[model samples]
Target: MPLLSYSRSYSPTAADVGHVIRVECKATKRVGGGVLTKTVDTGLVLPFPPMPPRRQMLANVNEERLTPRLRQIGVFRVLTYNILAEIYATRQMYPYCPIWALSWSFRRELLKRELQSYNADIICLQEVQGDHYKSFFAPMMEEWGYEGWYLKKSRESMGLEGKVDGCALFYKRNRFILKERYPVDFNELANDFLKQVQTEYDLDYQGPSMAAREMFLSTLNKMRQRLQRDNVAQITVLEVVPANNEMVARKSQSGPLICVANVHIFSNPKFPDVKMWQTNMLAKQLERVTLNRNLPTILCGDFNSEPSSAVYEFMTRNHVPLDHPDIQHPPPQLANIYASLDLEHNIGFASAYASVFGAEPEYTNYTGAISRIGCDYRRSLTEALLLVIRSLDRCGGLRMVHTGDADSVRRAEGTPT
Candidate 1:
C-alpha cells in the first residue's frame, strides 16, 4: 500500500494480509450533475479529526506525509466501541432488522460504512468477536488499505456469550509500521482480584451505595475480561512509544506522536476506589516506563467515573501527591493529554452518547443501560462509535495547511479555519 504508517501483526494469519480495495463515491450534490463519483484510490482518508486547527491541518495532509506527525509515515484511524456483544444480535431480532443478518452482514456493513466515512487508517475496536471480525470486517477493511490487531484472549467463561467485549486494533498497511504490542493481562488478573476483593455479602452489601457497587463489581467479576487499556499515558512515555516498539514509532523518532488508550472499565458500584487505584497503577507504570524521556501521551477511554473522581484528579495533576511524596508519592510524571496539547482553553469535551444521536443512523449493533437506541441496537453501537470520533475532534492537535479541499464523505460540521 502507498499509505505510509505503522503496522503490527502479532502472528500473521491469512486474515492479516492487506488487499487494495477501491471505493467509488458516486453522488449528486447539484454541483457535479450526473452523480459525479469516483474512487478514493485506496479508500485511505482522515480519521475522526480533533478540532484543533493544527490537528485539522494534520488530518488534511496527504496520507503519505502524515506518518511523521503520526510518527510512522501514516495516521492510525482507531475506533473503540462497546458492541453489547452479550445481547446476541444473531438469534434475537430487533424491530427492523433480522437477527443473524444484523449480527453478521448488517453490523459488518454498518462498520464498513463508518469506516468508509472516516477513511480511517488504523482502528482500535472493543466489544468485538474474533470469529466474526476475521470472517467479515477484515476482508472489507483490507479493501480500504490495512491489516489488523486484536487482544489475544477469549471471553468464554463469564457466560457472556459471543464476542463479549475484547479490544482489537486495525492498521492500514500504508499508514503503519508494525510496532510492539502489549496485552493488558486483564484475564490473568481478574480472577485473583475478584476472589480477594469480593465482599462476603456481594449482592447484599449494606454500606452507602455499596449494594449497587456490589452489583457493579459483580459485573466486573463477571466481565473482567474487558477493560483492557485506557489511553492515559504520561505525555512523555506516549511520545516515545516508538522507543519501546519500533513499528508503532519511527526508528529515528525524536519522539512519538500522541498515543491514545481506548479503554472501557466496568462502571459498577463497590469499592469504586479500585478503579482509581487501577488508573494510578497505570499512571505509575507509564511513569516508570517513560522516566527520563519526553513523549506526548493521551489516556482516553470510557472511565465511567464522573470527571470529579480521584482517577480524574490524579490524572489531571500528572499524578501528583495529595500529601507528601514519600507518603502519597508524587504521581510518577504523567500529564493529562489535553493539557499536554495546550490546556488553557477547553482542549476537549466529551458528550453523553445520547447527545450525539442527532438523526437516527440506518443500522446498529448494541446498547447499554445508559445508552438507548433510536434506530436499532446498532444505534448504540453507532453512538459508541462516534465517541472515538468526538474525542479526536475535540483533541486531535493538528493545524490546517490547506482549505476548501475536503474529502467528500469526510466533511466536518465546522467550516475550514
Candidate 2:
C-alpha cells in the first residue's frame, strides 16, 4: 500500500484575462498498492466580460466658455452608481440573468474592473452589502489609494447573520482630506421630530381637554410609524488638496472644503409620500449640516423618483406646495398631513445632468422588467468650482457632461452672472 495526497488550488492572472477558467478533479482506488484516477471537469467557467470604453466629457456652449477660468480653481469628476446588492440579485427578481452571472463572486470581478476604469476623484455607490464592504471594498479601495465610509440601512438585519445593504462613499486620499462626517438615520430623525411635536403641543395647550390631546397624540403616533423607514444618507465635508504652487503662495494652509452627500431614498412607488418625506428630510439635514458656512455641495443618490415626480420638482424648484398631487396618496389621515407638510428648502440645487445635457438621460437604470431614472447628481454653487460629470449605463458604454460656476457663467442654465 502507498500513501497518496493531492493538491487542489488555482489563481488566475493577467495572462488569463480573455480566457475561460475551468477546474477538473480526479479520484480512484486501486485494489493492490497504487492509486488509479478518473478525471471530470465541472461546468463552471469564469469569463471576462468586455470592458466599457472610457467616458468622454461633453461640454455645453456655456461650459466651454468657462473651462479656462474653472481650471485655475480646481476640477474633479464624480460618479454615482447603484451596484445591485447580492441579497436582491435573486433568480425571482431577475429571471433573465443566468444563475452564475448573478452570483456575487462572479459579478464583483466585473464591478472591480468597471470601477477602476472610471478613475474618478470621488465615487458614490448604493446597495453595498455589509460583509462585502468589510471583506472586499474597503481593503481593495484602500489599495487603490481611496478612503471609504459606509452606513447600513437603519433596521434590524433581515438577511443572513443580520447582514444588510448600505451606501458606500470613497474619495481619493491624495486628492481630498475628510473634515467632518454625519451619518443620517432617517428613522431616528422621525422619532426625534415626533418628540418635538409632543413637547410643543404640551407647551402650547392651556385647556385640560383630555380627548383632544388623545386624538392629537394618536395622529402623531401614526405619522411616526409612517415615517420610520430605514433609509439613510452620508454627509461628509472634504477639504481639497491644494496645488504645489497654491500651497506655497497662500499664507493659510487650509484648502477649500466641499460638502458631499450620498443617499438612497425609499423605493416604493405605491407610497410616493414616503419618498417625498425622505427627500424633504434629507434637504433639511443638509441645511443644518452646512450652516455658518456655505460650502460648495455635491449631492449624489439613488432617488428612485423620476423627473416627472414631485420629488424631482421639489429638488429643482426648492419648494413643493402641500397640495401637490404626488403627496396626496391614500390613507386619508396621512394624506391630509402630507398635504400640509411644508416642503421647502433653500439649498438651490440644480440637476447636474439636466443642466449640462439640457435634459437627463431617458434612463439611469435599466433592466429587463423595469427601466428607471433613479441615480443622479445635484450641484450646489456656493464657491468657484468646475464639475465634469460622466455616467455609464449598466449595459451601454458611457456619457459625460462638463459644467462650471464661473463669475461670467454662474450656472449652466444662464443665471445672472
Best-fitting candidate, scored by lDDT? 2
Best by TM-score: 2
Clashes of each: 50, 0
lDDT of 1 by residue, 1-417 (tens): 343323321222344245444444556877756677675544322233233233222232333433344443123444444543434454433443333334454355456655576565445565556565666666777777766655524345245334444556665555444444445544344454445445543534666486677555655543343333222211111232333555644545544434444454444434234455455544444444333433233343545443334444455444524332222221222211112211111222232232233322232223232233333322233222323222233333332212222232123321211
Write model 2 residue lDDT over 64-103, tens digit each, in one string: 3443323443667688777888888898977766787788
Q: What lDDT would each prediction earn against the true structure?
A: 0.40, 0.69
How far residue 369's Cα lies from its native spot in candidate 2, in Å, is 1.4
- RMSD (CA, Å), each prediction: 17.2, 9.6
What residue runs in model 2 are displaced by over 4 Å at the alpha carbon? 1-41, 44-56, 61-73, 204-211, 245-252, 370-417
